[model samples]
Target: MSNPHPLQVERRGSGVPILCLHGHPGSGSAMAVFTEPLSTRYHTLAPDLRGYGQSQVQDPFEMADHIADLEALLDREGIEECLILGWSLGGILAMELALRNPQRYRGLILIGTAARPRGNYPPIPWWEYVNTGIAGLINGVKPGWQWNIDTFGTRSLFRRLLKQHTPTAYHYLAHAGTPAYLRTSRHAHRALNTALRQGYNRLADLPTLTMPCLMVAGADDINITAQSSQETAQTLPRCDWHCFPNTAHLFPWEVPNAMNETIHAWLRQQNL
Candidate 1:
């Protein structure tokens, strides 16, 4: 296999290692609020995956390459084993990692992740076209249209959508402010295209996983539905599933404290 770009990591605290992975179009910084609080008890390491944040950009962002990058990160850190807290795309990668090397993982914390590819080509919403057109027009006339759309515009739209589900959580995400390194249009498109082309589905393999897992979903998640998480929970041998009412796909960002507390409590119960 070819070498991947060197991963940029944010490390804090000292104790059991816990790797934090972020979603597509997001950087390790996006996960900072969630990982930072746990620093006191657990050694938290969040990395910027290839083409996102401070990490080097590379073409052909295949899932295999991501898995390899993670392996390299662990080897570089000299971590024999650690726990994983994955959100969205990160959650998918975490599952893949566990399947590839179960012994290296102590437990899994998956939030708003699907066990398999929901479909080859999911339907694009009609509103998205309108949003794109509006964004394009604004960008054409304005100098910083791209940044504005990618940052404020995108976050605003998500905040509105999330508000319908969880008002308090929406407020939190709205104030977080989008990071510049996280707004990657090209990388997002490439990653999604690769996953679709590969027919990414791990549903069948879910039953084979024996490690302790915690699956969380937002009841009103528009991206990955809660039903998918429910099904995943049913398939896993030792899994705890929780669906927060009136919460959306960005639950991790919206309610970082709650999510962190829940994860910490679960880890204590598992003695990990």
Candidate 2:
């Protein structure tokens, strides 16, 4: 929690608090997809995760390190009550924080989120090495380097990914420090390996969480399979799951209006 580089956070609007959590391969600004729309009614607080965007980088690669940072940030900002919204990896961290300390938040909106990542199962972790090898090749980076972010994407991949996000997404992508997203992706894969080695699993912990939750999933997300989606839905004590038809993991960016309205409605419904 000392001088956390990835914990960079920004406040927006002037109403009920809404904490926006971004995904892996992203900084806090990734919430740019929702802020403009939500800020109209709800105050939005978006933070770059440790080692992602304008946030400070630090030691201890575990996600719990981030939970601590979030708690500290909230305390400092006098944000004692809020609605929690998280996408992708940020979703995982959100659930972890809520489970560990549910009193801090009023409710949750899970986007393309999961209670547990699919790992250490029928398929071995070897795929990570393969993908990292390929991703490294595509990124022209070897592990253990300082992670030059400029090489994060080739022109083709960048163009394709750019097509899926928004101008705000572009703003985040265009930031000079945003290149860290690529390295974070590579590093998260390795971190996932470390989590597996420690014998920790997301599934076994999901049912322990009793917080009120609303989960929104892309029908076509490759990152989180449909089966896992159902599992996440069932694990919660209070949850409403909505599967976005014909959408992928990038649906929030692809359909920002729909995502924004859905989230606003959820918050209003919960009165958070």
Candidate 3:
């Protein structure tokens, strides 16, 4: 395989390194909320995956490519080992990283994620379907979904899907109005489509993960159900699962203080 394009990273604080990975249609900025808090105690390194944010865009935006990009980033940083905290699609990539390089990570923190892509997505609401179709059509004409974000501002149709799952944090979690946001969204669309076609499933490999793992889920997350998180936790050899009541997909954003506290406590307990 060819080398992945260089990634742009946001580095903060200094201590045990924590590699933070963001979800689809988002850049390293998506994880910015946690960086400052995590930075106080640990070295937080958040990278914009290839073709996202300021990273170079390339072809074949698949999971493997994502994995390679991370590997290269770690190497570049001279980080032989670090803790990984991934959210949503980022969690899937974190798992893939552990599978490929088990010795390189100290532990895993998965938030609002599942062990695999759940094919049973509920039917799209009529209003959402119409708006999404319109957005897609417009985005198709203009490579990036910039027009959508520009026209709609903070209430862009692309981000509206998140509103259902992250009502409180929807606006707070909106993508920055930057060229990188548009570029990332365009690349993310391709990467997600490829991921769906590949049918990602890592259940069988979960038991092989011997490192300490923390699975955090939101009870009301409609995107990746709590049931999925529970099932994933059950599969892991060493896992601690926690579900926040009344919270949804963007629990970290919704309750950053609480989330950071929990994570700090967990890391201290693990001595990592």
Summarize candidate 2's per-residue lDDT along 1-272 as a digit string, tens digits.
Answer: 24433367777898988888888777666677777788888899998776566664444466666787788888888888887889877788788888788887778888887776542123335444454334445334332122322333322233223234334333334442146455365445555557657753477776766667888877766666545666787788788878777665667755667877787777777776
> Residue-wise lDDT of candidate 1 within 81-172, one digit each (tens)?
99998888899989999999999999999988888634222456667656645543454455344454564445444533352324344333
For this target, which candidate reaches the highest lDDT against the unseen true structure?
3
Pitting candidate 2 against candidate 3, the one with the higher TM-score is 3
User: lDDT tens digits, residues 84-141, model 3?
Assistant: 9998888999999999989999999998898964532455556665665565455445
- Residue 80 in model 2: lDDT: 87
Ranking by lDDT: 3, 1, 2
Collision count for each candidate, in order: 0, 9, 0
Compute the lDDT of residue 230 as modeled in candidate 1.
78
The runs of at least 3 residues in candidate 1 whose Cα sits more than 4 Å from the true structure, single-residue gaps closed, are 117-156, 159-161, 164-177, 180-185
Q: Which stretches of candidate 3 lie over 4 Å from their true place?
A: 119-121, 129-171, 175-181
Give the local distance difference test score of model 2: 0.66
